[model samples]
Target: MSVVIEQPKSPRSRKAANWEKYGWMYMRASGAILLILIFGHLYVNLFVGQGIKGIDFAFVAGKWANPFWKVWDGLMLWLALIHGTNGMRTIANDYAERPMVRKVLNYTLWIVCAALIILGTLVITTFDPCIDPNASTYLPGVCAVK
Candidate 1:
């Protein structure tokens, strides 16, 4: 007796637009962009000035004060979260045996990703270093002067 392996049937309804293809392209594009963004971020934070020792709340505040860094960080947060969520979705589709389980996992992944992206963007965009009254001693001279 021999066991027979059968190929899965294709979907009967074909969509005019291909989402899987778009998702594949997005992964490649986002990965390239993330490589540059992550490296540049590391170089600036870890290699510049006093190196790793220079990283502090004040340092982050100073960076966020600049519109350029704000955009950079925001883009990085959004891209990375979406990229991760998409990757997890693909994994779920491939490995999840139950349709309900796959659907629940994918939904949870996107919900968490969306929530984090929103919170991170808000923090980056609205960060105020001078808001803490007790932080004057730990904060930079600029915060005290302001």
Candidate 2:
């Protein structure tokens, strides 16, 4: 039996801007940064001080109280969301045969990502450690004074 292989199609004739190139570069860059951000987050949350046992609302509140951690977490949130969305877009482009389906899937992915990014940014920027009145008992000593 003989097997036949078809040659790939030629590139598009129009010389449009290379978005895929940029997306590929972004994936590499973001993956590297994400490695650092994820590992640092894990180290701080799981290995420092009392470790996992120390994780609580108060612990999160304490971390977000600092601007550095806030920016770090916010950056992680945005980058991860964008990176994941873009990766999924690439997959949808490859696997989805219908153009409308691909468009809908991509749009949904982007909308969800945008919403989460906005909500996450707002939370990171406007978070108040002492906002809860009923949970004061579970809060840290700092919340009592605030």
Top model number, TM-score? 1
Q: Listing every candidate in turn, what is its Cα RMSD in Å to the true structure after a full C-alpha superposition?
A: 5.2, 5.7
- Which candidate has the top score in lDDT? 2
- Give the CA lDDT, 0 to 100, for residue 20 in model 1: 68
Write down the worst ten-residue block by lDDT for model 2: 1-10
TM-score of each model, paired residue for residue: 0.84, 0.83
**Going through the candidates in order, what is the number of backbone clashes in each?**
0, 0
C-alpha local distance difference test of each model: 0.83, 0.84
Per-residue CA lDDT of model 1 for 1-146, tens digit only, reads: 22221222323335445566677778999999999999999999999999999988888877876899999999999999999999998888778877788779989999999999999988987888878776666765546643
Clashing residue pairs, backbone N/CA/C < 3 A, model 1: none
